[model samples]
Target: MRYIAIDVGSTFLKAGQLDVQNLAITHMESIRMPEPLPNENPLRKEWNAIQLLELMKGLIDRQLASCPGCKGIWITTQMHGFIITDEYGVADTPYISWQDERGLEYADKLGTSYFSALMDRVGEKAWRRTGLWEKPGVAAVGLFHMLQQADLGLEIKRERQGKACAASMNDIQTLDSKRLCTLGGYLIQSLTGSHVCHITNAAPTGLVDVRAGKWDKDIVSAVGCQALQFPRIVVGIDSVGHYHSRWGGVPVYPDIGDHQASVLGSLADAKNEAIVNMGTAGWISRVSDAYRIGEWELRPYFEGRYLPTITKLPGGRNMAVLVRFIADVGQSIYGITLTEDTLWERLLAEADSFSQKFLAGERQAGKGQLHVHVGFYGGQTGTDSGAIDCINGDNLQVGGLFAAAMEEIAAIYERNLYVLATAGEAIRRITFSGGVMMKNAFLRDAIAKAVGIEAVMAPERDEVFLGLLRLALVSEGLYASVEETREVLLQKLHANNKGA
Candidate 1:
């Protein structure tokens, strides 16, 4: 059997064909996602919902054309972010991106931010029920901000009509018919005409009760959006509807979270293994049988499992800051131009060489080492910043700079891993995935050494596509469980390698 797999990623829209019998992915391709729509407020990031949907449809159509007799469609998407829709599932507002930060804007004369005011209104217990911290860009916070704006608009309208406007926070007629959904849920609704969300995709919105696997009524009421409709929550292996096209009607499964899918594709043992993924952003995640409230964020996983994750770690984007700096210096100071790829190649070579020597104690004590922090983009707390210190004439070279950055990232992972351990997650093995980890052996090795455990790479480079393939196998009843499916697939892959 064959299936079409798609990932609506933050950075790219990726698609491919998954051959179930052989467990291979073919015709894999990706296109950069459309840039966010221009905004007057620098912190507000958004996209044209209809335009993004059209682009996704075009990509899916292209893949469907290439793979004849495709049995079904499986999707995974970047978690969080939401779009407001009408009853017919048509977008009513721009897609608010997970990167949007309007919630961080000050909301009162005393200078409390929208996010802070939201937390105060919801209370700590209600917020903790969602298994998330008080942060901006979550769907719940966005919904609150929307309601406030509507109230303000309504008050102005009443004033213009020369009527007394009473505070009717719950009586906004404009929001009466509105619904909320993540980008993935919206895509499913657009394709299959069914308004449903998988638990994995919905859990990150800071609205769902992770332990109960449903929306928390208290949080909804606290946000003053009890009237707003949210998609019905679906669990494991359920089809939303069938997508009709020139080929035929294909079964479309509810979209899953990309983070969970990537970890699933890595084939890590949920009982004893943890995964570290580095893409545009980075996270370290480990699955738990029961939900636990702690420093880590808890997200829903397949089959009643939960993932305790440390997210927003420095990642590829942070490294690009340094690379772009070098590129700018070359162009501006020396009239030389270098592609990012070329610069990365040279930097990696230098960093790798220096790392080997440093690990072997070849450098004099503190002679060629620098302290580097690559948090150019903020961290989980949203206040962290990047820095490079201990810079001297001997350690200010490119090799030293990159080596320090890699070490610092590894150190950050190590610190987070300790936190996970303290919280009682016994992670015996580590599986590394994502573009940065897969391409950079130096970084992978640094992470392994820092964590004091040898790590292994994920079986496939495209973990998200591979994850969709695994989901198809289980959903089609080929395997009773994820563990069993992984075991069989790896066995076949090993046999194939032996024959080759």
Candidate 2:
């Protein structure tokens, strides 16, 4: 069987056809992700959900032109972002960026003292009931009200042990009867005409009961969202709808979060591996079968496990900033527009020389320093503050500044890894992915040195799309389950990579 995989990302949209039997991508193409308004303040970070849906349809149609035998279509999208839909499943507003800062204001108004007190009262219970910690950034709570806000009505129901529990009413009335949906849910509705949420995408919303795999009514009430405001939950491999394409009917599987999909597509042994994907944003995720939640935020993964991850908001964006800074400085001083690639090459050369000198004990620490820090979304330690402190001289060149930034990024990754390690999580190896490490060998080695682990590149260049392929195989009955698909794919990759 063959499948078409769509990966809707913040900066790029990728679609491809994969031959399941041979584990080969028949054809793949990527384009810049469409944004509605490039200059608008809040909307700048957002994409038009309807426009994206149409773009996806076009991409799939184009791919079908070459590979008409595709069996299914699976989607994996950027997480923590969402779109608003109407009662009839029509998009009501533009898709909102998860990086929006509205939630910060809301949290600040609540204050640390007040918020901490509230967390002390309901945090543990919320975690137990909803599988989410009470944090502003963990869930896209910062952008939750972009759709609608209303109080929820609850009904009493009995569990298996005949214990009374608060059940959400089926009919949740919003201020205008509109509802919230993730990018995946909205796309699913547009493609298959069904309103549903994949467990992987739902977990990041901070509204899902991670254990029960459903929306927690108490958490919904806390968000002022009625029951129906959240989409119906579906597992990763379930067939959500059938997309009718020109080739034929392709079974569409529920969309999974990009992080979860990357793990499924990249990790050979997820249980003992950590994944670090540095794209527009960066994250370090470690998977475990047990439902463990500690300092790091726990997200639901395929195969009924959990992913404890630390997200870096200004991930690869930091590198972009450095590239521009280097270009500007070079053009003003030397009258040349240097590309990022050139800057990176020079930076690596400078770093190599600096390392040699430092090893020879000839260079001092305080002088000629390039301090680069990328600020965090929330007040996360080691990343909450950013600065590039250096003197205006030969030392303030591209190589030193870029090397310092990479070191800071690696330092942050090391800290996140320590948090997971100290919590008793065993990490055997770290899998690296995303655009930041695409052709940069120096950054990869730097991250390995900082984390004190061998950082191996993911088998597939595009892990999210491969993850969608895994779901497509399961949805079309080519594979019995997600676990089976994962094992088989791993075996195929091992066999293929033996010669390399």
Off by over 4 Å in 1: 109-111, 154-173, 357-368, 381-383, 423-425
Q: Evaluated with TM-score, which candidate comes out highest? A: 1
TM-score of predicted structure 2: 0.83
Provide the global lDDT of candidate 1 against the true structure.
0.81
Candidate 1 versus truth, CA RMSD in Å, comes to: 4.7
**Each candidate: what lDDT?**
0.81, 0.68
Candidate 2 per-residue C-alpha lDDT over 252-345 given as tens digits, one digit per residue, 9 for 90 to 100 = 7787888888877775566677787888777777777787767777788877778777765347676777667767878999999867777767
What ranges in model 2 sit over 4 Å off?
Answer: 36-44, 106-124, 127-177, 227-229, 332-335, 357-370, 376-381, 390-395, 423-425, 475-491, 494-500
Tens digit of per-residue lDDT, candidate 1, span 66-147: 8888888898888888987777777766778788887887766426877888888889887877877677878888777767
